[model samples]
Target chain A: MRNRQKTEKDTPLGAEAAQRRHRAVLVILAAALILCLLLSFTLGRYPVPLRELLGILAAKLGLPVEPFWTRQMELAVWNIRLPRVLLSVLVGASLAAAGAGFQGVFQNPMASPDVLGASAGAGFGAALALLLDLSNSLVTLLAFGMSLLTVALVFLIGRYVKGDRLVGLVLSGIIIGSLCQSATSFIKLVADPTNKLPQITYWLMGSLSGASWRDVRLAVLPMLLGLALLLLSRWQINVLTMGDDEARSLGVNAPRVRARIILCSTLLTASAVSVSGMIGWVGLVIPHMMRRIAGSDYRYLMGASVLGGGIFLLAVDNLSRTVSESGIPIGILTAFIGAPFFIWLITGRVDHYDG
Target chain B: MTVEVEHLAFAYDEKPVLTDVSFTAREGQFLSILGPNGAGKSTLFRCILGLQTKYTGSVRIGGTDTKTLSPREMAGLVAYIPQSSRPTFNYSVFDIVLMGASRKLSPFRAPSREDNERCRWALEKVGISHLAQRCFHRLSGGEQQLVMIARALMQDAPVLMMDEPTANLDYGNQLLVMRQAKALTKEGYTVIQTTHAPEQSYLFSDRILALSGGRIIQDGPPAEVLTGETVETLYGISVRVVSLENDKMRVCMPINII
Candidate 1:
């Protein structure tokens, strides 16, 4: 018995090895995200060299490196390229992490940030702002507020409806989301087709163009808070997937944990959609890909989704700006790219989407 | 540890389920609850587990009222092992077992190194250490049941409450689970299981409680309680209580089949 105890204390072989593999996968994902970050800085309209980019990064961090880059390069890198790239990364990470959280909380593989209608509601908020010719910051603020309001409405309606609580919440989201969609349609119908119509339509299509540092500042706090809370409560998500009765038996307060997850995910989705204007498939597709890569232990899956999302959106955002003289809307590009990639992932792999 | 339930009556919106049920189980005793489908066995278990608080009566564990205990305290008193079912996500067996330690942790805290050690020890005790890295959904039904047993062990509770632990297993697997439960009783842990199988209780349980229509009809040693008449009354199926190997073992066989 003493010998067996010593052996067990050394960490059993199979599970330790598997954990090491999962850790390696997370490390690889982080490395890839860093690489994409560096690449995004250099691949914009006014190309910056790798050396100049490094110098500017060092200078920005208050290192003693001298700037060899021109003033035009500095302005492009710091002002235009920096905020857009950072916002894309932040928005991408938030959406994907929120998607993963929603999927776990709902115990459904197809669940995403939009599953609760945050995106649809934010779209309506942004449309109304555009039609009213509100300031850009007001558009973002209103979108964030209205997005949260929509989910609150869903939860309120869900409380009164009968049957399964999860089904009720999803049904309410669907109903309210369509309601917001038609409202946006009415806004479009009344606006001038020459100017206001095009503006509202472009905002709904989702873009990162003209993203300023102020926009990044506006979104950073809520996005970071949501991500931090989700990461802290990561293991609870795994417990919840066993179903509420089992979770309760395991000593977790299922309803409380579920509420925290939904609130955090809503914060993430609302903030991301408000700034980026309804970027869709990053939340849906990146998490599924991360599940294939990291396996489904939420401890690792949550971090993987965050990093995987940043890499995917950073890469896609680069493509959006540089692929043509006129930048394509990110929402259009995400669906255009995400759909076929998702199909290939599902078909090429012998995996099922139970979670 | 001792469990005492007194005058436990429960109703769902005016429809009575379990009525005036009372029982006591001490440590190291293997208690089997035999009842027909919809006999309120599940509702009784739910009340004891503190999942249903609407029941009228007192449930005490280790002489403390269960009503006053927090969920974490309740988990520390008794661990629940549900019948094997596939989860939505295919979590690794180690991760699933580690979750049993959540009661000892705060909501935001992950399992510590000590918790992981306990989890490994529990898996080894359950003789499924080899499956620690395997995905839960990929395991066989018997193996899944053992995994759940390991999880309960990781809970480090004094009593283990199982909901039909061997319900869907084959004959060999059923015996395997029963032997494990019996062994737990020998280790001085209270083992309470609910099942429809009378012969299983006859072979393994130290005491049997026969429940019919939300009431306890009989409670005693298996030999005193699992008679031919009691079996017929519980299940409404006539059966012959057959003795094997000089009454060393008992088996129930149904009679009057068309």
Candidate 2:
């Protein structure tokens, strides 16, 4: 059992130094996110120049700057691109943070924001709203309410199950999620093939198209509340990763902490999905990538996931708007890009997860 | 802190796991509970730690009833070291040990500079200061056990309860961990650990509580409680307890049965 002992010099940095390093990494991620935001402002179809974009932003902020940009340019920035871009960032950060939180709370590597069926329920809600020919705002409202209701149902069923609580919750999620998918399929079968069918399909594919300031306002409360709570609960979440019994020994009330985490994650997932229909892969992939960069401490991991996720989805959304005349759905791009990368990550380093 | 128990009876559903179990461990006392695989040693430790509270008994730590205490108060009175197991994520050893400071803080507070200093002190106490930054999963079984002991030290409680701390270690590492447990007692910490090896209790424990089938068979000093008859009663094995000539240490050897 005796390996050659290393001197202090041979060891890595101390705990404080390592924490400082992780903070630096988070700062770097934030900077990258700002860069993506800047680049996204200029990359759309209307082609707003960098200077004019800044001028419009300054005018919007009520600064003492001259309006060198045209009214059309102002409309493009304020009406179309700004809401879409801002919504992408909010949705991305929410999904990623929620994903990271769920993974940690469940202590399962494959756990994502949709583990409790929030996304599936939101998807079904949106599809039903479309079939009934509801307005856009109503669609979002129904989706949000439905998502919360789905998770609440999952909890009720989970409480009645026989085995481990986490396991019961997961199994209930699968069962409820499949039921929602089947309902969505039935709605698709009954809707108008040319109009409602296409709308439901595109919405389920997940997109930030037609994003408005209202969508942002509606999603902000729940998402911000969830994100802030999750961030504050980071230390408790770390204690929880040691397992229920160990957490109890450390004076942590594991059940209450777990309930708080689940509530926050559900809020985040529901808000994000209600805004942007059922976007997959960002929640699962971004946090996994952040683990490699930020090292698994939730203090850094949550922040890194938020920034990294915003940058990733914003970049992908930019590509979606610019890559074609009609723009690809954001979800399609995330899955296309995320699946192979996830496989590579799992295969590239076997030790990243416990076998 | 002195641990006191009275009529500690526990059962899972309809089956009884511990029956009428009671013992007192005083300050600076190294107590070992020796039992076989199916014995109620672990269940008894669980009751004392407050992890399993469905038992019909009273457990008082330092004169405070455990049922009257919150989990945080219970943790302040006693720290537990579970058998080493791999975590899902590969957190660093420093992070793992730092978690022990949770017992003293509010739910939302992270470890502070003072907590970090305490972690460093705990690591140094276990002689693994250089391994703080290393990944916990990469460490050897013995090193992991030391890391856990260091975590328990970080809890800074007067009482330490270990459930088979050296269950997965080799021979030398077993003695190494036992020596550390014994040393903790000298520092005025009440060390209570459960072990399957009679020799471990014979060597390091000030008091031995031999448990079998949900009951205590014997409770006394090592020399008085670790007789051959006690070993046979605990493990259902015929063993000879021999005292070394020079070191005056007692060791048990099982007899060959045809």
What i-RMS does each candidate reach, in Å? Answer: 4.7, 3.1
Output the lDDT of residue A351, model 1.
38
Error of 1 at A108 (Å): 0.9
Please list the C-alpha lDDT of all candidates, in the order they appear.
0.89, 0.89
Q: Which of the numbered candidates is closest to the native, going by highest TM-score?
A: 2
Give the per-residue Cα lDDT of candidate 2 at B256. Answer: 65
Off by over 4 Å in 1: A1-11, A350-355
Top DockQ prediction, candidate number: 2
Candidate 2 is scored at a TM of 0.97
lDDT of 1 by residue, A1-355 (tens): 4454344446556566666778899999999988888888778579888899989878999999877889888889999999999999999999999999999999998999998889999999999999999999999999999999999999899888898888999999999999999999999999999999999999998899878999899999999999999999989999998888788888898888999999999999999999989898999999899989888889889999999999999899999988987899888999999999999887875432222
The residue-by-residue lDDT of candidate 2 on B190-223, one tens digit each, is: 9999988788778889999999899988999988
- For each candidate in turn, give its C-alpha RMSD to the true structure in angstroms: 3.5, 2.4
User: In model 1, what is the error at residue A72, expressed in angstroms?
Assistant: 1.1
Q: Is the docking of candidate 2 incorrect, acceptable, medium or high quality?
A: medium
The stretch of ten residues in a row with the least summed lDDT in candidate 1 chain A is A1-10
